[model samples]
Target: MESWGNSTTVTEFVLLGLSRNPQVRAGLFVIFLVMYLIAVAGNSLIVVLIVVDSHLHTPMYFFLSNLSFIDVCYVTTSVPQMLVHSFTERPTISYGRCFGQMSIAVCLAETEFLLLAVMAYDRLVAICNPLRYSLIMNGKVCIILALGLWTFPVLLTLVTFLTLQVNMCGHNVVNHFKCEVQAVLKLACSSTRINGIIMVLASSFTLLFPFIFILVTYGRIGFAVLRIRSAQGRGKALSTCGSHLAVVGIFYGTALAMYLRPQAKRFTNREKVMAIFYGVITPMLNPMIYSMRNREVKGALWRVIGRKVGK
Candidate 1:
């Protein structure tokens, strides 16, 4: 507890990270540190490829770049801190810093949810309405969509963050490694009926609706792919949409399971393990998923490598 003038509040939180065993902590640290570095490097490579390769300057790559950027940021928000806390005997975070971390996590999550939906739409346009793909998803339109992806999530997160700033009554021991909003909310001593309502609403908007939108958009894309007369055309269409769908499945599946499920009073080890899926594992997998399965991305990478070697 800390005092401000005459009032006392929780100024810091002691984080009970993943393991208490020093050997276990050391092992987890090495594995996660390797993952974190791979995630950052992989995502950064995609961004660089997209920027330098003019042929890849379309709506799909634009959104892919955005996704990569988000994954990089998303993992950075929690993983580094988690890594630090993992090995520490008494890992702690300041109250203000915890709030900031929670807020950023919320914003990035909401943004990625909406962004994935937008990517599905872009694929739908390219495959379903090929003739009008350029006209329908013009640069101006893509820019507008990108702006909305970044802006709207921040606004929504702000509302959720504000509602979460309730009286915690000096309960400052965080069960999980990171400052997850829901985990933090459990510490609040004040009536959290409004906060719960707001959380449900926010989750519905950010997680539920966007997930449904992606599914429906893919449904339409599936139909359009079937209509293609050429087997090669159909295969190409599937290839284009497949990587995005894979990412969507891993991301949305873990996210929905974590956020929309019935709330638990205590943050279980199972929940802590679940948090690693979306927070750490997903980002690491994303760039590899996109690059390995994507021919154009691979070609762009080789081209860049060839140029460097030639120079």
Candidate 2:
């Protein structure tokens, strides 16, 4: 990863960020700044709530704490930098820093997808195998799963980056904001055929496979829910799964649109807009979705607030 390509030395990349107009950039700066703050504060609160409350010490919240921590890191990976660049006249990221951010983003994003599938399976076991849920998803099992979920993505990212044998030849103007893998690939003077193959293989494991697994897992959960004779019981089952399903739909929808689309279509302004949905919107919405739908989370929030107020 030297900045030097074969012919020319490339030291930095100029980012043609989200907007060009000064007024538009100013407005975007304000809006995205607010979004960044809200996402950080909200996810941070979820992590805090899960940690401080005994009621949230179950396998589900343990995974959620991981999710919250990931979301905080995920958004922080790009948003703060993006915010600063938004208002600046010339937005640039160093060659080394650009790939550094991309690698971190990949690790966090892929880990979130894998963690979501694990959460779905957790819900399935809890709902379908209620009698042995605790034993099945015991403390040791949860720890191992969390470790795998986090570890696999880091390796995937590292492998993906190492395999990208790209030569820039001094071409370094990135069209979109941030160092998105696709956008960077488009700048390669060398053939990206090998890089494309590697990315597709990696995306299959990180995005497509986990998405299918989640769908199948949820299908079984749906069937099990239908067997519940009581309407209340059925509703409870759906409520438990609903929050997770909603998050999955938003995440996978945006991600598939971003990664799995026909590669013939080059990275464009539309792609940058699409990236915001998963990159910014989903992380902001995760805690709100879970807290609003989950009574336990709401209860924990109140109890924590009550203690502070009482003191």
- The candidate that achieves the highest lDDT relative to the unseen native structure: 2
lDDT string for model 2 (1-111, tens) is 332223246668888988899899889989989998989999999999999999999999999999889989988888888888877888889888887888999989999
lDDT of 1 at 265: 82
Q: By TM-score, who's the top model here?
A: 2
**Decoy 1 TM-score against native:** 0.96
Residue 71 alpha-carbon offset, candidate 1, angstroms: 0.6
Each candidate's TM vs. the true structure? 0.96, 0.96
All candidates' lDDT scores?
A: 0.87, 0.88
